[model samples]
Target: MELSELTIHKAHELLKQKKISSLELTMALLERIDACDEKIGAYISIAGEKAIDQAKIADEAIAKGNISPLTGIPVSIKDLICTKGIRTTCASKMLENFVPFYDAFVIKKLKKENAVILGKVNMDEFAMGSSTENSSIKITHNPWDLSRIPGGSSGGSAASVAADLCLASLGSDTGGSIRQPASHCGVVGIKPTYGRVSRFGLIAFASSLDQIGPLTKDVTDSAIMMNAVSGYDRNDSTSVSVDVPDYTSFCKKGLNGLRVGIPKEFHSYKGLDPEVDLAVKNAVKTLEDLGALSVEISLPHTEYTVAAYYVIAPAEASSNLARYDGVKYGFRDMDKKTLIEMYKGTRSQGFGDEVKRRIILGTYVLSAGYYDAYYRKASQVRALITEDFKKAFKKCDVILSPVAPTPAFTIGEKADDPLTMYLSDIFTLSANLAGIPGMSLPCGFSKSGLPIGLQIMGMHFNEEKIFKTAFNFEQATEFHNKKPMR
Candidate 1:
């Protein structure tokens, strides 16, 4: 079975009726991973036996009629997320051998739902870099075009779903990690409102901006996957205390009265491919045809998002990574002669260049003379970015924008230049800073035949509205049906 063709809802029905067992579903994914993962390099480590054990338990529960929408679905987890007994490397040598005794809040949620854990997918080291090239182990190639990159740091998760190695996967989006990769892979990915989903088990990138979200094959599946994991958790201090709603209940409410805001700033971004721009434009036309309204708007503070995020995110990363010293946990070089040697050797050997670079920059900004100048000021700018979204939401139900300036670039195109690679995250940084929900679904293909994504951003805790709108758009277009030549 092509796992990508199976919707989360359909899998649930099949499981409840005993037409399929969770063990069989898990085996199917394991078989798919065995067949295609070598070509895609999606999974850093596939949990063959452990996943089957979980599936057997799921089958038992379903046979007893204790069912959920995700009861029998097999899903992959990004390596950044701790999976207890499973090796939870954030694609960094630092934690390559470390395994958490506890599960992340999201992981616990999935276990309760009886979802099969496919394995740990690869990602950038310490969640740095826009491409998975920063991974300490191996590079994750794009399933869309093997020579090009699958966007990171969620590249492995996106590639797995795109190549049908798993039904869906969880990814963290601090900047464009989730959306960018989803666009590159031609799948559905959503970065929920910060705090909407708990971040307890996720390896820190930017604590304030980071979120765990689902990457699946369609809007409906995205909603179903989201439902299984979203909600407040006491473990994560930043988790919001909002009421969780029946997200799937509203998935079919067509976009009849939806008001979508299209920011004018998106059209004039430098180096935006003409084909991608045209594709987004056509998407607006399709929305109108489906009885939705699109109106031009301006996020006047859009330009500051990138500048502010770099400073703010790094400041947090500098602090978060401090725990990786040899004395604490993770990587430790045993042959060190002195205390300083031990600390230096462990970090130098554990973290990749991009991760080290971010730690240095972050530390520098938060250091004595620079804190007030860079870190503090960037926080102020972050406020304005969030305010821009708050104000925009007052005028529209959802904001529609391009996921990235262009389609998937070649594997080594931006890998050499850190700044050039960071620029590709231009369109997505704002949503993270704003701490709102954002999603990227396939809008159309580029002239060169690569995929382009249309980002749907919503106000605080308004994922239902975003889902209703995206579902309507998905039903009206065939863009999501265009599979990559895997």
Candidate 2:
């Protein structure tokens, strides 16, 4: 079988049964990259030597009768997550040469499980854009349609998985980063409840909103990866102490009697295309066909979420990115004579326009005089959004909606208008603000040949139920089997 065509579960089964060696799988994937990556540009770097070494060790471990489900399974890590001693640039020029000394909580987990790290995938600079075109280093085109985008921040990871460059990949979501890309690439990506996955060593875009999750070809693969990575980390100040459930056991549970809600307010948001609405409505019907009951619910404060995210995310980013001054970290423009001049010069030169724009905007909003007006108002709005979700969850196990307002747009479609691009996240951002798990999967496709995804929002720490629901729908529907026109 082609490396790209194999699901993570299938790969694991083959490895366990000795049908294929871990080394062989690693080599086949590497050869595929050699054949196709230049044109697709899905990866920023390919850790071939390390992946091969890791695969050999995995084979040796299995030979010794020591094994785990993830052992030898290959994964592409998103560029935003820190990998010890590796160039962990967050797809930004400021950290192009920055190498972290410690592994992120997720990276540590993957290593502990013996998963082979293929390399870091590209992303939007500081995760600010919806399209991968905002990547500081290079533009990543959709494998399904080269003229269009693969969605972003986690765009490279989504593209890699969808195009079969790797079995699965790690993607971080701040607002809609992971799930949006998953929607565009026609794969599965879940944004776990905030603090559910440790943020320690993940480059902060919006500290409170950022979350690490898995992007896989199927819900089962995502469940396996989630079980391997989700946990409490002492190193992460915000990490929750709640016990992470065994995702595999509950994933196969049928969705009979499950109560799913369709947010009436979110479904009516502007910019939603007619085709997307039809696809999502059809997906809801499929859930009903699978024995789940669906009802209309309301997230009353939906309007305030976008207003709050823009402010709160930037405020947190400004504070978190403060450490990037020339003297201690990030790029250093040593040409300046004075220390302060050096800081300004390096930041101005190193950061892309989007990063610079956010930093400045964030700094301004959080400034001594303006905090109450912009930052404080946004914080208050955040509370309202959370309260709204609390009320809605009382009525349903999860909320179902469109992952994005529209299907994958052409490459340059949303690039020029920052505000327009930001609106793309309108549907998925509320889950993050409320600290809930959200996921996107192929519900169906549009007539133009692009994919359509349904967004699923689950209650806090209820990831098992989320996957159970996803897995059930996945088994019942034929949508998951449709591949992009690659």
Candidate 3:
């Protein structure tokens, strides 16, 4: 197998046997990025020199018989995550040139394990849009079909892994950013339960809704990444103080007694493509054949999920994004005559239309008179949504559904209609709103050859169940083994 295409586990085995050096593997991936990234537009920046230096350090450690799963593995990080001495642009002009002096908690963990950072990948501006076309820097096209979007705001993260530009990538999910893109790009992506991963140094989009997770070539790589990045961190107050299991150990076969819940609402939803519905239904039968039981379940408040998420996410985004005024770091308007004028001018020139739209919606929802009408009601509905998941979990171990309504759509299909774009994430928004773990892996392909994703959601911190189920399904099918011809 080509070095760049090796999974994390496979590469580590070869490195352990001294068949390959960290420098050699890192160079292979860097070369792959160099050759293909122009067409993929996966990276916002590439840390070639620094990555080589890190790979050398990993080689020294490996020579001394010390290594980790991620040691010397070339990885890409979504631009929203901060890295010390690396420019972490959230694909917005406001912080296009901003460089952080401190690394995010996840980056610190990856660095400690000696993972070679291939640098930042692109995303929607401030992670506010469903399609990567909202990115101010560059539009990331789907590797499957260059005419379609790779999904967003983690489009680059998913595309990078799908195209083998990087072995794996870290992507933050807010209202389905990670899973949706992974679904569209035909790769494995997981969003752990809220607080399962630390959020410090993650550029805030919706503080309450955002959670960082990995997008990889398969479920095993996802587990390897989970093992490396999951755990408590004092830097983030929301970081849950709990034991993180070795996620890799749970990538086992046989779902003998596992109960898979199928929400009727999702399958019956309007606008769902027939191919995606049939794919997910077939996946359910596959699980049944594997000795699993499929139970028809209902997340009763499912219809309110999108509305509630839009209100709550935007409200939090408004509060969290208030610090980006020109007075502080990031882009500034030097020609403004007054402080207020400067703030307005800088933000006006900095943020993109999608970001400005969310900020406006957020500010409006949080306004004095409107707070009780919109934000407060949304919060109440959010609680109901969370409770619905809790109740559904009582009937089954994990919930299974389609990740999106359809496979990747054309680049400009929904760009002009914001509501249509928002609905693209309907199946995924509930998981984020309820703060549960969710994942997407390739299930099948549409007639036109676009990939479809099967979403598996676990209650709270039960990511092990998600990993196990996805791994089992992946092994039973050949979808995960297929790659887009680049």
Candidate 4:
């Protein structure tokens, strides 16, 4: 296997045996990025020299016999996650040149483990769109087919893993950012329960719904990553103080006695693609064959998930994004005569169309006359959605479904229709709404050869259950071993 294609587990084994050096692995991936990233548009910036320096440090640690699963692994960070010295653009002109002095909590964890930081990857502007076409910098293409999108706003993160440009990556999930892209690119992406991973330096999109998680080449790699980054941080008030388990231990071979729930609402959606439905159903049957009991469950409020999410997420986005005005830092419009004009001009010129659209919709919803009618109602509906999941979990250990309604569409296919683009995340929005753990793994491929994903959701903070279920399914099928022919 190519050095760049090695999973975190494999790389660690080789590195510990002195069969390969961290510098060699890092160089291989750097070379791979040089060759493939231009065609994939998976990165916003590449820190070649910085990455090599980190790799050298990792090698020194490995020589000392002090290495973690990720000690020398090459990993990518979604642009939205702040890195102390590296440029963290969030794929928007608003902070296009911004650099932070402090790393995100997850970055701190990775740094402590000596993981080589490859570079920052592209995404939707401030993580506002379902397709990466909303990126102000570049549109990330699926490694499976260059003509199609790699999903978003973590499109770059998923594409990098799919293309073997990076062994694994960190991505923020708000709505379906991480899982949707992983589904499209045929990789494993997990969104931990809200507060499971600290969000100290994550560029806020929807404060209540946003989470940091892993996008990796396989389920085992995802587990290894979760061990390093999942924990509490004193800096983030929203971070939970719960104890994190060894996620890798959950990747066992059997699913005997496990109960899998099939939400009637999810499977019955009229917009679901026939191929995606079949792929997910087959995944469920594979689990059943492995001794899991399948049960029919109802999340009665499922239909309101999209509406509630659109309201709550955008409203929080508007509030969180208000700090990007020209005053403090980031891009400033020097030509503006007054402070107010500067704010208006900078935001109007800096943010992309989708970001502006969400901000406007958010502002309108949070406006005095509409707050009680829109935002307040959405919050109530959000509670109902949460209740639905809580009640469903009473019937099964995990819930299974399709990650998205369809395989990745052509780039620009839904660019003109905002509503259609929004609907793309219909199956994924509820998890964020309910603040639960969710994951997407490769299940099958479409007739056109695009990858399909099977989503497994567990109760809040019960990632181990989801991991066990996904791992069992992975071991039973060859889907996780399939790579895109770029």
Candidate 5:
């Protein structure tokens, strides 16, 4: 196997055994990115020299017997996470030249573990779209089928991992950004329970719904990445004071005594692709055969997920993104003389169409005349959605569903229709809305050979359960082992 394709655990084993040095592994990945990233368009910035320097330091640490699972691993980062001295664009022209003075909480954790960061990958501009074509920077193509979208907001993160450009990546999930893309790209992506991982440095789209997580080649790697980054943070008010468990320990647990919930509403949803439906049903049967109890459950409010999410997410985004006027650190229109003109001109020129559309919708919803009619009602629906998940969890240990309604569609297929694009995240928005842990991993493939993802969600702070379930299924199937042809 190519060194660039090695999982974090495997690479750590080789590094600790002196079979390979961090420099060699890092270089192998850099070479892979150099050779393949052009066609994939997975990266917005490449930090080759910095990664080499970090790898050298990691090798020295390994020699001193200070190695961890990620000590010598190479990984990619979503561009929205702030990295000190590295340009953090958020895939928007607004912050194209912006560099952070400090690292995000997750980046600090990764650095402490001596992980080498290859570069910042692309995303939907301000995380406002379902397809990466919304990126003002570049269009990240699916490695499985170059003509199709990899999926969005975290498209580049998933694409890089699937294409072996990087072993794993860090991505933020707000309304299914992480899992949908992971499904489209055929990789493992986890969104820990809200406040499980610190969001201190993440560029916020919807502060209440955003959670930082990992995208990896397999389930074990996902656990390793989660272990390094999950913990209470004094810097973030929303971060809960909870003990972080050893996620890796749960990976070996079999499916015996596990209860998996299948939501009736999801299976009966209109427009679900037959291929995806078959794959998920087969996955449920496979779980049953492995001694897991499959129970039909109801999250009756599931039908309202898409409508509720759009209103709540955009409302939060409107308030959070208001800081990007001309006076801040990002782009400013100096050509305008009046202050208001500068503010208007900067935002008009800086943000992309999707971003502007969301901002306008958000602002309108939050206005005095409409707040009671839109944002307030959405908040009520959000509470109901959370209640729905709470009720469903009482009946099962974990919930299983398709990550997306269909396999990845070709780029531009739904770009002109924002409502259709929002529906792409129907299966995933509930987890984020309820602030619970969720994951996406390969279950099967579409008839056209595109990948299909199976989602496993657990109660808040119960990532161990999700990991145990995902690992068992991954062991039984070869879906995750299949790589995209470059």
Candidate 6:
């Protein structure tokens, strides 16, 4: 395999054996990005000289016997994650040139491991859209088919991993961003339980629902990444102070006696594509053949996931996004004479249309006269959704479903239909709402050759269970071994 195509574990093995240098691996990836990123539009910026310097430092550390699983490995960062001295534009003009003075909690951990920083990848502006078409910077194309979107708002992260532009990448998932894109691009992605990974430096979309996770080339790499980034952080108030297990150890645990939950509602979803449904069902049967017990369960509130999530997520987003009012360090209109005009001009010109729509919807829901009818009802529904999952998990160890209702559509297919775009995450919004661990891995392909993803969900902070289940399925199928023919 080409050095740029090497998985994280494979690269680590080569680096540890003294058969290859960190510089060589870094150079190969950089060359790949240089050759292919223009067509993919996966990155917002390239670290260039800084990455090379870090690789040299990693090589020196390796020579001294200082090594870790991630040491000398090159990885990509989503533009929304703060990196000290690097422009952390959340793919919006508001903070287009903004730079941070400190690294995010996860970035700090990666740096401590001596992992070479590749660069920042694109995403929906402020992570507000599903297809990545809303990114103010660039529209990231699916490497599998340039005419289609790679899913979003972590479209760039998944695309980069799929295209081998980076060995692995970090993405923030508020709804289905990471998992949906990973499914579309035929890669592996996992979103840990809320607070399992710190959000200290993640640019907030919905504070309560947002999480940081990894998108990798395989399930094993996903586990290695989880081991490095998952932990409690004093810096983030929402971070849970719980012990994190060694995720890699769970990969080999077979599915014997594992109870798989099949929600009755998911199979009956109105818009579920026939290809996606068959693939997910086949995946379940494969697990059963490997010794798993399948049980029919009900998440009664599953139908309300999209409605409740839209209300709650946008409400938090409106509150969290109010900080950029032109009075702060972000972009400001110098020509505006009045403070209010400057605030209006800055935001009106900075944010994209989808962001503005959510802010307006959120502001409307939270208004004094409508709060009881909208926001309060949504909160109550959220509680019910959480309860639904709690009751369902009692009978099953993990939940199985389709990551998305359909394979990736053409780039502009749903761009004009806001409600249709919202439905793209119908199957995924529940996990974020329930604050549980969930993941997406390649399970099958559509007739058109697009990828399909199978979602695996586990109870709160039970990522090891999810990993164990996905790992066994991965070992049994060769779907993940297929790459996009760019």
Residue lDDT tens for model 5, 21-67: 99999999999899989899999999999999999999999999999
Residue pairs in candidate 5 whose N, alpha carbon or C atoms collide under 3 angstroms: none
Give the C-alpha miss distance for residue 468 in model 6, angstroms.
0.5
For residues 266-305, write the lDDT of model 2, one tens digit per residue: 7788788999999999888988988899988988888787
For each candidate in turn, the TM-score is 0.98, 0.98, 0.99, 0.99, 0.99, 0.99
Worst 10 residues of 4 by lDDT: 418-427
Cα lDDT tens digits, model 6, 76-153, are: 999999999999999999989999999999999999999999999999999988888999888899999999999998
- Per-residue lDDT of model 4, residues 1-486, tens digit only: 899989999999999999999999999999999998989999999999999999999999999999889998999999999999999999999998999999999999999999999999999999888778999899899999999999999999999999999999999999999999999999999999999999999999999999999999899999999999999899999899999999999999888899999999998999999999999999988999999999999999988888899999989999999998888879998899998999999999998889989999999999989999999999999999999999999999999999999999999899999988888788899999999999999999999999999999999889999999989889889988888885
- What global local distance difference test value does model 4 have? 0.94
How big is the RMSD of model 3? 0.7
**Clashes in model 1: which pairs?**
none
Alpha-carbon RMSD of each model: 1.2, 1.1, 0.7, 0.7, 0.7, 0.7
Model 2 residue 152 distance off true place after TM-score fit, in angstroms: 1.0
Candidate 6 Cα outliers beyond 4 Å, as residue runs: none
Model 2 CA RMSD to the hidden true structure, in angstroms = 1.1
Clashing pairs in 2: none
Model 2 segments more than 4 A misplaced: none
Lowest lDDT block of 10, candidate 2: 477-486
Ten contiguous residues minimizing lDDT sum, candidate 3: 416-425
Clashes of 2: 0
Alpha carbon deviation, residue 155, candidate 1 (Å): 0.4
Question: Compared with the true structure, what per-residue lDDT tens digits does model 1 show for residues 24-59?
Answer: 778878987897789899999889998999999999
CA lDDT, every model vs. true structure: 0.88, 0.88, 0.93, 0.94, 0.93, 0.94
Candidate 3 Cα lDDT to native: 0.93
lDDT of model 5, residue 280: 95
In model 1, which regions exceed 4 Å deviation? Answer: 1-4
